[model samples]
Target chain A: MSQKILTRMGDGERLAMDAQEIRDDIRRGTAEAARRAGVPELTEAEQEELFAILAEPGRIVSVEPGREVIVTDDGCSMSFYSGQDGGGVGAPLSRLQAVLTYERACGADTTSMGHSDYSYKPVKPIINFEANDYYNISQVTTAPFLYGAQPNMGLYFQPDGPCANAAELMPLGKIDEARAAQEEACEHLRRDLVFVGRRLAEVGLEGLNFDTCGSAGDADYLAALQAVEELKKDLPDLPIIMGGAGEFVLGMHGGVEYQGRRLAGLYPHEQVKVAEAAGVDIYGVAVSTATTESVAWNLARAVTFVKAASEASSIPVHANVGMGVCGVPMMEQPPIDAVTRVSKALVQIGKADGL
Target chain B: MSEALFQASVDAVVRGDAKKAEELARQGLAEGIEPLVLINQAFVPGINQVGEMFGAGKLFLPELIMSAKAMQAATDIINAAIPEGNAQEGRGRFVIGTVEGDVHDIGKTIVVALLKANGFEVLDLGRDVPTDRLIEEADKFNAHIIGTSALLTTTMPAQQKLEEALKKAGLKGRFKTMVGGAPVTERWAKKIGADGFAEDAGAAVVVAKQLLATN
Candidate 1:
């Protein structure tokens, strides 16, 4: 019999379950989510492949070196805080240098200037578009020197800042006021994205990532969708990677709609259709982990969601796997065993084009 | 007539109408209804129902937040009318913030709202708060628990620093410490000697209550 696979729960508890049991859980978990989402379930061959991958007796696993897929990261922060203290203490030139070091070491396909406050709202005030043509122009101009050979280098931000402000209104029973605020914030966010996209494009930036879209619910998602639509019209060739904060939209605004579909309660399969409609070049799918559940369970569920999303999407599918989502343990540094297995499952079985 | 008013109070909260909930609360006060009676019979049930629906996935974050706001608006009025000395007895005091160098406040904000709905007196220090400031404010508030949240790996050290600072001050035993965030795990909590670890807002409440009960 294959050795019993060791894994950890979402909360970091150790579990050593029979290989067959883990395979069974993977099938059962994936089927249940597929049924609920009205997406196609995995075929028997795909299930068997996932089982084989998990049953392998290795401390860590990876795709065959020649068969490796593209790897990209959102909010790449390692280079941002290169100094001894916790804060972002490094200068721009040194930070870019660190990105170069990380790229060569880790073999990431692309690198980003990870902002602690990675949102357009906070960066808006600092960006004097009229005077300098870009916010943080120093970093924007210098990134090309280090990353000249890379096909893509761009800006990333979450549409989360305004969502927080709108949520504040809901408590005072200011529902209408909150809704109006979200609408206004959406417009402002779209304008900021356009301004930044245009400025970055002028300096050879090739992509933009709307990381963690819809974290504040429907309105937040709407803002990102609209921004992508606007950005596509301005720069048709620019690739936009739209990643979600959760598997399903939270319905925070509860009643907002986009392109006639309700923005609230949208699962990955449903979410990708809207993203594609808005001209998203790459759809980043995420499934949150249940801390009490085992990694096998979370990985199976994440695969199920990602596979459905990949099938339904016309755009490339990038699976977000790290920390708390995509079957990785919810910790600062995830164990390599879980990470490798999840990555392999997503690419081979879930049909993910990138990670 | 009184029964109808109480039902209306519950409905106002379910509807997430803070102004209506506040209005009904004032009306109840004017009619000589006991403050505690209004809270126990009306607002608590309303917020409880909201929490239940949220867990069931029938409600989402906005609906839940609005309901909590409505419940708070009514409860604040009712709480003030209670006898001063009897007020806030046994209800734990919680001091919460996103630690310094981290601006992610959504998770911390949700915890604050839920804690308030669950009857804890919460002092929200907001985001990017320094470690020393958290201790100082918690001490001033006589807080029973101090919760720190850090969303980034770099900022997570702030939580460990908070733990060290509390020990250095010789106040470790006095205040129960809770740590949470997207990147935070139970292992980190134990490694840093934190008293409690919550994976999300719902778990935060349970861990907090258990921590208080144990001590």
Candidate 2:
């Protein structure tokens, strides 16, 4: 006699629904996503295994002792100074602190030195392309590398924020102007990323994480792909991790295309192909949680998408399991119950290489 | 004849042609059409359709932003001709920003455009704005509501701080507070004592209206 499992709404409401219904929905959603992505659907046995994990009555669920996988994180913070901006620690110290904690305390296999300048547009003033006066990338990456952590440098391509604002293209109804401005911004961002990538290579940075790629839609995705392609030309051995900001590529520049493929509305399976073409080593998949739906519903949908993407990809697929996405609830601190269940599903059903 | 011009106004907004929308608005005004009538009958319907299409996944962010821009451009012109005291009579004023240390603003930007389309005088303080500045602007603008957005878990404390600061300043009763962002949940809004929370721009408009009505 299986008991009803507890689930959560996207808005954080707790509800108890029949476990069988949840399983059925997961199967249906997963099959549809797999069919749409033109990838292999989860086998009947895999679906049953996923249902058992989701239906567990425990407060949290985890993989058995030896089935653990590699772990990576984006926007690793400096927790030294709580409530203070940048943790009151300089770049070098912050990077050191984050890597130390993730490696020794959290037992993370790899850590990231995530640097965000609010928006990429503002980086122009702070970055001296001609010299190393602006960014301390080499120093920051070197410390983590020497400390025995597989360190990756993460940056965001949030083109919608500053890029769209600066162009003022929307207000004046200048669609072409907006598209052209985004294209120009892409060039500047590509140069900046390549410059940073070179600095990382100088220090033998383990990997490069284009964290939150395509948040501003297709234009943002294009920028990251262009940068990765250029960097691979010079530093072929350098591994690149491209993490998506959402589950789909928004047609912000609805008409924009990359490698002759229109990018306005692409799912994760389709997105992986473009990332592979751009020479990305690892592809991170993000599936947004629908706040109005049950956690069971969200998890099923997320795994379905990830499963298709994983099967279709030639490279390792790392599922992004964080706040408000990948079946995790949208909260400052997502409940451990949901996180564990989501992590377990991604590993068992989605067949992800990392989380 | 008037119906044809009105439909053209609607078509311009749907197509996201700011110049055409503006030109149609001017033409309507020159033809002795009432400014409010033109907005209410023509442009509002266009924006509303865009919002509906966006919610249904028929359009994307760039299209949505473009539509909002067209609506805004036409509204700016038509709104200017209305008499000073008669305009902004019952419609409320709103102040919004992304919380300090959170630089993401696409969500907030969309909310601002939608609020403006719905006839609210919105003041967007841009991204990474401090709590003090948000309150100060709200006070100066005589705002009935102050909305703050935070995209990260680390910066969510700022929303709680805003709630505390409003209480400490004894301005809590003067204005309603709304919170939003990718990581912001309705429970967090309640925990922080915020008056309202919205998941997206379309929902923000509804929440703002509810908040204003109570105020």
Candidate 3:
């Protein structure tokens, strides 16, 4: 790892969450839901609100549509606090297949609004808010507009290769052609962060999902955080959902090599904590199918992490086991037995533990 | 007896033991394994297992891909050694590809294996195939079935383009066309005038067979 990539192996003893914890939390959620008399699973809207309470149970918030949010064809505008998910609203996405498709749909058709007053609807949609995750809020806010299968400029100008390393990124470093390629990539992300910030700020978002960055180590992480910061500047109320480094680091990297823990190496817990300390609306880890199931142990560890992060963070945390990993898609076709077992265990253990 | 060897071959392929899979297949051959017997017994069940596992999520894309490769290895040996006039000889020629802009192919690969296993001579065009080229290939091969897959919502239009190109080229009735993918509903396939449609690989062969007979 680069010196520039600072890590915080802090004594926060907040070490990683375990499978049992996740199973317990899941059970708790089920029991709580059962007591409520057939609310069934929590909706995406409800989960976001629950996270807000978890992130800072001290404050009040919501995720449903409301007066503070302004919807439009160009974009949606919101000015309310947001948190992350609570449960399986859309069949948990860890892969790009589901995420990319859903993100596109959410961006195209969805909008939100909210305030402390809470007028139109009872509780506002509790969207997750991660503020300190990047430098430019605008780039992240506008990211959806530029990316996805939808006809955004990112695709329009993109030269058809890796989104993170397209030659189209070169213009950002016009002044320094030698490092122009790298700088261009940075610039593109920075712009996307700003876009994300702008759109989200409209929804009172100072945070991000942090799942799609596809980066690791300090530099990539810092660049990502810097982009968040930039967006936060324009939208000061931003929050963040930090380091969804599912699959791999979710179990402390490769579990066995590190004595049945995620490798303490290069994982960015310290940076995320720093963001949390800075009053990020949300801060916690996340896992995906790839992160959770590269080994059977991963699936077990992921349940633990989801439980831990959900309860631990002052902000809402959740898991996203979408449909694909890198290119090897999975979510749509996990074994029936695995789904049954995982779901049962999560409800029995991870959910019951109250983390 | 051949059925037992075929079943063993499928088990070996699933376990990722290539040597074992090949040995079982060779054993079936020495026992005078009929191509169709091997296909129906070992290959179809094996690929069907892929479908079941995929549906259940026990296996992911890589596993599907790996199994397809494994099945192909076994198919090459089995198809060649068997006589040509076998009743189950797969001569219902089909050309398949992913629609433009969508590179996802795990679904298509399974369909390819099943199609070949079913005694259909399949021309797999791989992923992100353009519309015109798809039409060109089907016309070139005089294929009985022209298949298209679009995993992304945006690229689904290519399926329609394939249909239109065939109509424009006067090859409309020449090939029975089918389209598939996660987002591709059969209603959409019908709306776009596809001869057939399937949500998964196993059903694709069934649909392809029905489409060929209908055409």
Report how far off residue A229 is in candidate 3 (Å): 16
> Which parts of model 1 have CA positions greater than 4 angstroms off?
A1-3, A11-15, A20-49, A63-70, A75-181, A215-217, A290-292, B1-49, B52-58, B69-90
What level of docking quality does candidate 1 show?
incorrect
Tens digits of per-residue lDDT, candidate 3, A2-93, equal 11211101111112333444334434543432332222444434343332222322222222243121112111222112111111234433
Chain A only: list TM-scores of all candidates.
Answer: 0.83, 0.82, 0.39
Return the candidate ranking by DockQ, descending. Answer: 1, 2, 3
Question: Candidates' TM-scores?
Answer: 0.75, 0.74, 0.46
Model 3, B26-131: lDDT tens per residue?
Answer: 7777877676677668866776776565443345333444565566667777777777675443458999998888765545755775565455777887777888
What digit string (tens of lDDT, one per residue) describes model 2 on residues A1-355?
6677787776567777787787776777566556544556677787788788878889999987877877777644433323334332334444556556656667667655443443434443444441242134344433232111111111222333334452234433466776776666666667767776676466556677777687766777788888889999989988888888776775556776889988766778888999999999889899788676667767877888898888889998999986778888875457888889999999878888888
Candidate with best DockQ: 1
Residue-level lDDT tens digits of model 1 in B1-215: 77988999989988889999999999998898988888888787887777665543356666776787788788888888889886644778999999998766656766776777677788888778999999999999999999999877778999999999999999999999999987787878999999999987878888988988877
lDDT scores in order: 0.74, 0.74, 0.46
Tens-digit per-residue lDDT, A314-336, candidate 1: 88888988578888777655688
- What level of docking quality does candidate 2 show? incorrect
